[model samples]
Target: MKAILFEAPGSDPIFTDVELAKPQSSEVEVTITAAGVCHSDLHVVSGDWDIATPVVLGHEGSGIVSALGPGVTDLSIGDHVVLSWVPSCGTCRYCLAGRPAQCSLVASVVAPLGVLHDGTSRLSKDGRTLHHYLGVSSFAERVVVPVSGAIRVRMDAPLDVLALVGCAVATGVGAVTKTANVQPGSTVAVIGCGGVGLSCVQGARLAGVSRIIAVDIMPEKLELALRLGATDAIDSSSTDAVAALTEMVPEGLDYVFDAIGKISTTEQAIAALGLGGSAVIVGLPPTGQHARFDPLALAEADQRILGSNYGSVVPQRDIPWLVDLYLSGDLDLDSLVSARRPLSEAPAALVDLAAGHALRHLLVPSI
Candidate 1:
């Protein structure tokens, strides 16, 4: 298998050939078909997120179930599945409470994967152990992922289009539909016109939002946001976002989704809230990062600041429904794919992702 090795933070990923291993009793080995180059992977690759070195970095992906481990009867060989960053344990306080993303089992398993779990990973180069990223390191030809991290989808769904569903799409849509509970005809303003932000725009549209406003620094991205369903676009690089939106909606929007995960954006989302408006946080700021807002305004206006992780998605149910939406006229997955290339061209995709040029760059490994 050829995998992207994270040598250190702020360094380019090193692609290398490695060994292969069978699936564990609770795991499945997937033959990687399509992997989306997401900003989250860049966050790890940039070493902003603390993780052990020599790890494979990628989470949003979908592929065929090449093999299954013992006790894995729910899935069969050749089933198409989408990989989620969240690894859920069916028997947990959170999982039992219907919050799988908050499943406490993740921290327990992260250490092993970081140091090549299983005492020996199928990944290695020159006899050196390589760590795995996010439990589903989709940046390779194949990866061993826990069953909890996969959501089986219809095999017929276009794999390339659904790649965004793994992360960006799921997060964006989840923020609107699940986290914010966006009501039909609600006014929305999404900060950040990236993949996830654009998905939020589309999700708001699906929820029948009347005024979908997009804010971003990139002109091209703002254009993409309009195409994705944004009724209005604002280039924050020049104009004052808060002031501009204030002019549009004097009392503020019903929902403001801060997909950038920045302290400043959080503050803006909070300040721009309507009398009973809510602001949902979606970006992954580095660990320990914090944001500040006015307590007086929150109390006076009945405002709320919420944080959404993985779009509060139950992948098994959500991914399939999203697939159906794409099949129908609801969700447009094909439009999210800005470009596609073979797995060998993954490095270039990462570079382009860093440049903020595309929604998602899909990697067809078997291509």
Candidate 2:
């Protein structure tokens, strides 16, 4: 099958042929329908996050199940599913506590090795074993993932559109509703109007936030944020984002989300918080990157700096509900999709994404 391979950091990802092995026990093989291009994959390509290579590089996707492995009785062939990178073990402490995103196997093994739960690649190229990205590796025509990673959503929902719910939507919406738990009538600010950031805006709106402030350097993105749910927009290109946000919310924001994942935006999110407010770090900065903040201020004001991974989502519990929201029109997921391209155009799509050319691009294999 064809897949996009990132052989090394700081190099262009290649669209190439790869051999996919059959699914193992407690795993399932999904024929790729649509995969969402996300910044996390870019992080790997850009060398921001180091990983084993000759790796398939995509995590956010949706597809139809074609095969199921042993012990995977919960799902069956032909189920339309959304992929979750963090496929937690149900019996683990984290999963039992309703925190599957921080699953022990994912944290210590699957992620670092770029393989499935058993720590082996299901893909290979030219006699060399290829690594999986976040265990999903949905960039390919098909992927073999752990049963827990393939989340079954309603078959009626469009698989292409549902792809975003895998990552961007899950992370963004999860940060507000799950991680921060922003109360209705609270004020919120989200930096960066990309897929994740825009999702944050939508999540804030769904939480019934009184003021949803969206900040970004792009005018088009800011406009989109307003249309999504943001009550106010700040073009960081022409103005200071922090100063503008301060002017709009004199008392400071109840929750400030740094969806850009840069140290600067992370600091801005922290600085823009009100007393007892929380700064949700929803974006993933490059590995080894660090931010500086005033510890004294946080202590005095009773503020918090929360790191939200995968929006702290339990895919089994949350993905279905998100799909229902989309199907009911309560969630404007249709607006989030900017364009769709064939799987072969993934390299160019990544270039466009890095240039901030679109909101969310779907690489449809059948297209």
Best by lDDT: 2
lDDT of 2 by residue, 1-367 (tens): 9999888876789888999999999999999999999888888888888788878989999999999888889998999999999988788899898899999998888899888888888899889999998889999899999999999999888889999999999999999999999999999999998999999999999999999999999999999999998999998988988899999988898999999999999999999999999999999999998899999999999999999999988899999999998888878888888899999898888888899878889999998
Q: Tell me, by TM-score, which candidate is best.
A: 2
Q: Deviation in angstroms for 4 in model 1?
A: 0.9
lDDT by residue for model 1 over 99-147, one digit each (tens)?
Answer: 7766666656653346222344555667877776767888889988788
C-alpha lDDT of all candidate models, in order: 0.83, 0.92
Task: Estimate the overall C-alpha local distance difference test score of candidate 2.
Answer: 0.92
> How many residue pairs clash (N, CA or C atoms closer than 3 angstroms) in each of the candidate models, in the order given?
0, 0
Return model 1's CA RMSD, one decimal.
1.9
